[model samples]
Target: MPSNDNTPRADRQELAYLPVPFPKAPPKEPRFAALRTWWQEAWEEDGVLRAMWEDVLSAPEDGFRYMAPWLRAVLMVAGVSFIVLMAKAAGEVVLEGLHQLLTAVPKVQVGGDTSSGVFAVVDQPVRTYIAQHSAGLPVAASTVYTLWLLTGITGLVLGYLSRNNGVRAMWAGWGAASVFMVWTATPATSRPIAVGLAVLAWTVLSAFAMRGLTLRRRVGRPARPARVSVKPEIHVHVPAPAPAPVVEQHPHSGCPFRD
Candidate 1:
């Protein structure tokens, strides 16, 4: 038992400091932390391919902008164009394919009449109206293909120059495919306007893709540190002026002049 100051002296006791347990080791990061980080980063990003897929699935910040336009201008224009082009291309492709195919393989028809076919063929008034203007085609497609040599070459060169192997491979493959497609389809395009339309679509799509990539590149990159300019310090030697002497005066009762 300890005694108070007014009581008898007590035995001295050793002072002890607080015992703090070491901080628990920070939780171990998961083995696939890098993958998890990448997934987190990529999931939120509006990548061009991902955005396109989202658009297709009708999944995005806005489900489909085309559906809810206040003016409905784009929707109307697209609808009209879709109807017109569908009607025209439907007949044009069939007639042109049949016309070209018959010229190429006249015996593909069962009898003198072009009604029945050894292969699938459009029948009747279609065959009668258009025969001399076109010959039967082997392929049945109204596809238009156009490739810009400059664009493909530039993409290939840039891809090769890029640090990423995946990007390099992508551009290389795309360029080769574009060349092949344009080569094969250009000759087969029955209409003169198809080539022009193909060029326009190709340009427009490329512009959109470039715009998206440019935006991503700008947004994803880390900001650079701001530079600070340092100016040289100059020392001036202006001397302080000397203090003026102080005069003391006292007034005497009879000697005011002398004081």
Candidate 2:
């Protein structure tokens, strides 16, 4: 109506005023806090400390429970450190020792022909037969003996501590120890075949160790009875008041008796 108000409309006037949303930035974590969180996750998620702590608690009847709380705390930290260092050193030593042993031990050759290694086969049944038979026993008797001892001893001890766990836990312990032995033994290429046989020997030894005769005797003991308090007998006695003193009155004649 006002001459149509425009020869042409301005770009600014045509645009509508509308709010636009923006994303909020995440809160910053302090360096120390972030570091502590990382360490906590490492300890828990890796399960090293947790497993050790659980093992310690598993045998409350042992030295771990009677140990001074502070000393126990110190021992836990030091034990883990020692275990880590020992594992590293032991691995290096085993590898070097195995290399030396292999060098010293000569390979047999007949008629200009070389045969496959005595312990190179990977089939479990063949390994088992070799390990059990008198001939194969000569291949790695020491390694097999060591594995058997470790599995049996560890299974027995852990089984004793956790008697409630039954044979299953002891068997599991044996299995774990055997696997660890296989993993750690140097000259791994040759040992792979023997690992199964070693584990079988360990299983037999562990079964013998965890028969639980002593455990049964210990569990059969009667529990002590709880103490109870008894109240002392109470007696109360009240003597009757002496009979009221006797009152005697003599009657007097008339008003004169008042004198």
Best by TM-score: 2
Model 2 residue pairs with clashes: none
- Candidate 1, which segments miss by more than 4 Å at Cα? 1-176, 186-192, 212-259
Candidates' RMSD to native:
27.0, 19.7
lDDT of prediction 2: 0.56
Pairs with backbone N, CA or C atoms under 3 Å apart (clashes), candidate 1: 99-135, 99-136, 100-135, 100-136, 100-137, 101-136, 101-137, 102-136
lDDT of 1 by residue, 1-259 (tens): 9646553345655447768689899999989999877766665767544554555455345544553353245557889999999999999999997576445543343212534442112122123223321346443212110123334555655654553555544554654454334333433553244334444544554453343343334445687889989899999999999987665455554433321
Tens-digit lDDT track of model 2 for 88-125: 99999999987776554334221121224532222232
lDDT of every predicted structure (CA atoms)? 0.48, 0.56
TM-scores for the candidates: 0.18, 0.23
Best prediction by lDDT = 2
